[model samples]
Target: MLRRAPRECGSWWWDLDDVTETGLVPALGTAARMAAVLGKHALLEPSSLEWDWFERGRGGLGVHTRLGLMGSRLDDPELAEQARACRPVGHPAAEMSALLVTGPGERLDAEGEPRREPRLVELTVSPDPYGCWAEVAVHHDVWSPCDFGGEPHPAVHANNAPRLAAALRALDALLGVPGEPGEPTYFGVAEGHGLKAPELVDGLGPDLTDLL
Candidate 1:
C-alpha cells in the first residue's frame, strides 16, 4: 500500500509495501512519468543515498549525494556510469542502494549555474526495497511556518500544497493502492491541511514510461 505524511517545508513522503519484482518496474515507470509531468518547473536528476540505520543509534547514519545524468532518461546508459561513480573503488558497500530522483526548485544549468527565476519547488523520489517514497519541498531557505505547534494558514501553503496534492493523486493511481501516512520526520510532517487523495481511475492505460 501507499501512504503519506503531512507537508513540512513543502516536503511530504509516500510509503508503499509488498511490492513484487514484476511490480517494481512498473512502479518506477510511473514515477518517471510523474517526474516528467513536473519537469517543466524543475529538472529531475538521479542521486545516490547510503543508509546505515545502525551507525548512529536512533539518529543513524544517512547520506544523500546527488550522482549523475543531469537530464538523461531513467534508462540512459550514463546512469550506470553515474552509479559507478557513486561507489569508491575498494568499497562496494558504499555504493548507492536507493534509486533517487531529485528536482531542485532553482533554475540552474547542468554546471550548477543559475539561469532563470527561482520557483522554490523541489521534488524527490526514492524507489527501493527499503520503502518506496517521494518528497516535495518548496520555498527557499525558509519554509512555511505550519507545524504541530499551530494550524496552517492558507498563505503558508500558497506555493506548493496544491502541486503536492496533485502529485500524490497521480502517484496513487499509478501504484494501484492507497497508502497511509507514516510517522513524521524533520523532513516530512505527519499532518497536513487541504490534502486530498487521488481519485481511482478506471483504467491503467499506457502511462508507463521508462520500463525496465
Candidate 2:
C-alpha cells in the first residue's frame, strides 16, 4: 500500500491497494503504487478472495502524484508527507530539457493536427523505459499518435503505470492552486494559453540547453 502525507502536515495520505491496481494496466504496477498515494476512492471494499482493499475512480490522484515526485509539495502545510520513505528506482534530476504540457481543460481534443498549434508539454517522465520516461502523459487526445514512442503511452499500459498515476496526482495539486505558478516552473505552455504542451524543460528561465 502507498500513502501520501502532506509535507507540512506530514499527515495526509492517499491509499493505493488492489483497487488501484485493478484499474491500472498490469505493466504499470509500480507507477500505480505511486499513484495510490495520491487519492482515495469513494468506495472501498476488500475482496474476500484477494483480501485487499479496492478503490474506485482515480478522482484527483494524477496531479498530486506528480507534486509528490517533484518534492516541492513538501513545503505545503496543506499537502501531506509520504507515509513512508520513497526510494525511487533511481534518482531523478529536478529539471530536464524543456516545456511542460497542459492536459484536459488546458487543451482541446481534436482528432488531428497537433503541430498545427502544438499540443504537448515538455520534459515529461515517460512510463516506458524503452521510451523517454520524462515526456510522459495520460491525456490521450486524437492529436497525439503515440508519436513520442514509449512504454506507457497515455492510454497504453506499461511498468511505470503506477508512477504515471502518482505524477498525475502531483500535477492535480498545482492545478488546484488559483494564482500564478511559482518558481522554477518546469512545464511549458503553448503560445500563452490557446494550446497546451508538456514540460520539456525543468526550469523555463534557466535555459539548460548547453549545460544539459
Provide TM-scores for the models: 0.50, 0.17
**Candidate 1 residue lDDT tens string, 1-212:** 11112333234455545432323344345456656655543433333222222221233235445554455665455554555465444444453334545444433322445443333444444544455665544432122224222334334345444444565555556555544444443433334532322222352211211221
- Itemize residue pairs with steric clashes in candidate 1: 2-179, 2-180, 3-179, 3-180, 4-181, 6-189, 11-136
- Indicate which candidate wins on TM-score: 1
Q: Which model scores highest in lDDT?
A: 1
Relative to the unseen true structure, what is the C-alpha lDDT of residue 13 in candidate 2, on a scale of 0 to 100?
A: 22
Off-target runs (Cα >4 Å) in candidate 2 are 1-80, 85-105, 109-135, 145-212
Query: Tens-digit lDDT track for model 2 on 48-162?
Result: 1001111133222121122222332222323222311221323222111111222211222233211211222222222222222212222222212221221113432222223
